[model samples]
Target: MEHRIATFLSRLSRTWLAAAVLAAVAIASATPAPAQDFITVASTTSTEQSGLFKHLLPEFKKATGIEARVVAVGTGQALDMGRKGDADVVFVHDKVAEEKFLAEGFGVKRLEVMYNDFIIVGPKNDPAGAKGKDVVEALKKIAGTSTPFTSRADKSGTHAAELRYWKLAGFDPPKGAWYRETGSGMGPTLNTASGMNAYALTDRGTWLSFKNRGELVILVEGDTKLFNQYGVMLVNPAKHPHVKKDSGQKFVDWVVSPAGQAAIAAYKIDGEQLFFPNAKP
Candidate 1:
């Protein structure tokens, strides 16, 4: 009789233990998961097409547990997004536009991050006699010869720079049957250039990563005026109270930091470094 009672108590205890385990699991299943930390960055298409963010964001996430969501567009659009408080950070290659954004109180601060030169790519056959000319001089020749040239007329930094060169070349917004404005990003404009065997101005980073070259080759480069400078800024929290100030500043700081500069410098294609880090001390 005592042994029977002992077995019944043991079974009862086992049943209660099983019931407790089931209750714990049900409670755990109903609990919500912790929200992930993330920030949105408005940046230029060159960084996205060049695969720079793909190479850098993973490292950033691993280091800070903050996911960076990038909206890659032309510099004009990127700055517009910042002005509208759609992004926490803006990373773009247009210093003048960025300064204007800051002056308008859309961005709090601007820091020069990295640089790469722009190059004018055209047919290797050199139909326009523009080969080996200085970048501005090349534009002059293309305008003079009326050679087919593609332009990203989306008000991007590239487009703005192309306009500057045209202005210097005595052609303000060169318009002709030969000048084609695609109103697209760098990569797509390059694709247009490649398709029509036309000349197009492009940042070196995009040109290095671009693989759709049909007859296009670098016809003009190495001009100091071709320098392409990139900058990063935090959206003004004063204007956009919802802006992720801390997180955005963190990204801006890290990008100019030695570690972030190293990551940018390390990105290469076919043994050619795409961007050179020159963040001010």
Candidate 2:
């Protein structure tokens, strides 16, 4: 009887050990791995709307095995995200704001990534008679004639550029039915302008990718002031210790690299290049 009891006790111990081992294994398997291989990038809606991130990020991941999750907002919002340490990197088009970010120690450095000019899009009928005119003069006509111009008053890089043009044109656009502010992104603002049969200033890239153009055409372009430049920078790790510095820097380096530049140069809509890669690395 004693020998049988001892044997039973040994078997029970083995069973308990096996159960403990299985529980440990289950816990280990259920635990998630660290997500250090991915980084968050705050960028402009123009990049997202133009479909550049879709084309560029895949190649970046394939080459580096690091995933870049993009948060598409306006340039101002993007920079603000960097300032608040909400983003690992910033890719935006507003040079003044980008410079300000760098100067304020929010970003490590600003590197020019690409460029696309802004164009005045209007109805084919050209009610404002802005077609084939200088952009400033076009705004003046739109304001003077009160011909239903849609302004992206969302404080985006495009919006900043538009305000600059208005300042140069020497008139604060009258706040009324004629000057409509669509506190939205480029694509939506363009769609609003299209639906209203109004005029809007838009980046050429978004204009090219837009499909709901409905009688809208590029009314004004080729002016030097319409030139738009995009920049990229890693959020300062010194400011935000939680920032994924290595992964963010890798993405920044990859974008300005030859392969990345090639990818940017390769993306086109209907065989027309949208963004020109002019990264001065």
Candidate 3:
């Protein structure tokens, strides 16, 4: 009886140990794993609207195993987000603003990423007679005729370029019905112009990818002033200690790298390339 009792005790001990191990395993299996590596990038609406991020970020993730999450806004807002330490990196156009951001110590440095030109898109009827004309002359005509012009007015790179053209044209567009401000992004502004049969300035990439173009057509292009250059930079870790510096720098380096440039060059719509890779080695 004593031997039988000892045997039964040993079996019970073994069973208890096994049950404890199984319970631990079940608890671990039920628990969630930590998040994967990721970095936040504040970029322009044109990049998002053109679907460049969708095409580019996946490849970046596949290559480096680091996910890039983008917040698409105007260049000004993107820089603002960097200033507030809400972003790990920034990618935007508008060289003047980018330079100012670097000078203000918001970013480590600016690296040119790509380039595209802006074009004047207008109604097919060409009421303002802007087609094939010089861009400044086209703006002047649009302003002079008070032809319905849709402005992004969102402090975007495209809006900045439009303001520069207006200044060069020697006039300030007043608040009126003919000159409408969308206070929105590039894609919506283009859509509004299309819907209203008005004129708007848009980057070539967004213009190419935009499918809602109602009666609008490219009216003016090929001006040297219309050149749009995009830049990338890591947010200053000194200002934002919480920033993912390593991940952000990796993203910047990858974007300017040869493989990244090739990837950017590879993205196309309907057999036409969008952004041209102009990053220097």
Candidate 4:
């Protein structure tokens, strides 16, 4: 009788163990799935700081159900991030740099996303006498004088354009006590320019978004050379072997899509458009 009772108890324990395991499995199966479908995009500060991403990304998320996590830096840094496989996509404003990145096999392809021109901002008084529609000529005047000019010398797209304008104006990357190179993003560099009342070259989007004007005002604009073209590219998955290619390409495809272009065109500050979507259909 004792042996029989021992066997019965052992069977009961096994039944309970099986029931517990089944219950645990059921609970796990009923649990919600992880919603971590996202891609990292290395983009420029102009897109982020100018509130373009704030307005644009949500629309993208709604359409694709994939989140775009942006690392907003200068265009150069963004490209570098793509090169290092630190990001799944690169969205930046330098066509030359973007082409170089593609040529070097870091990016799969480059597509034009949008375009916004750059403007020269300076003190309201225009101390450098740089106020004009001619960007190159305005830069020339600023350099000719010992006018304090602030440069975002972080090798950014804006900085590259600034240097190009200088070179076009027949100056060799002007450097002196009058020139200040702040190795910083667009917003901070603009802040510095405001603080110093120094001349600065900035994208129209950022210039519009910036509120701490102090004495700064748009001094020069409407020059063809100041045209800033933004491009998007996917990081080469074959090169990285770990890149989220499907999601990244989805974003690239969406950004140039009709819906994306409409969304970009709809984003405005005080009804003033920020970025004009120029994505070719």
Please list the Cα RMSD from the true structure of every candidate, rounded to 1 decimal place.
3.7, 1.2, 2.0, 2.7
* Ordering by lDDT: 3, 2, 1, 4
Pairs that collide, model 4: none
What are the lDDT scores of the predictions, listed in order? 0.93, 0.93, 0.94, 0.92
TM-score of 1: 0.89
Which ranges of candidate 3 are over 4 A from the true structure? 1-19
Best of the candidates, lDDT: 3
Output the lDDT of residue 93, model 3. Answer: 98
lDDT of 3 at 3: 100
Candidate 2, residues 58-151, lDDT tens digits: the string is: 9999999999999999999999999999999999999999999999999998999999999999999998798875988888888888899898
Model 3 C-alpha lDDT versus the unseen true structure:
0.94
Candidate 1: tens digits of C-alpha lDDT, residues 1-281: 99999999999999999999999999999999887889999999999999899999997888777999999999999999999999999999888898999999898889999999899999999888897748878888898999999999998898899999999999987988999999999999999999999999999899999999998999898889999999999999999999989988889989999989999999999999999999998
Model 3 clash count equals 0
- Best of the two (1, 3) by lDDT: 3
Q: Write the per-residue lDDT of candidate 3 for residues 1-281, one digit (tens) a residue.
A: 99999999999999999999999999999999998999999999999999999999999998899999999999999999999999999999999999999999999989999999999999999999988748899988888898999999999888998998988898664456899999999999998999999999999999999999999999999989889999999999999999999989999999999989999999999999999999998
Using Cα atoms with residue i matched to residue i, what is each candidate's TM-score against the true structure? 0.89, 0.97, 0.92, 0.92
Q: Roughly what TM-score does model 4 have, to 2 decimal places? A: 0.92
What is the Cα root-mean-square deviation between model 4 and the actual structure? 2.7
Q: In candidate 2, list every pair of residues with a backbone clash.
A: none
Error of 3 at 55 (Å): 1.8
Clashing pairs in 3: none
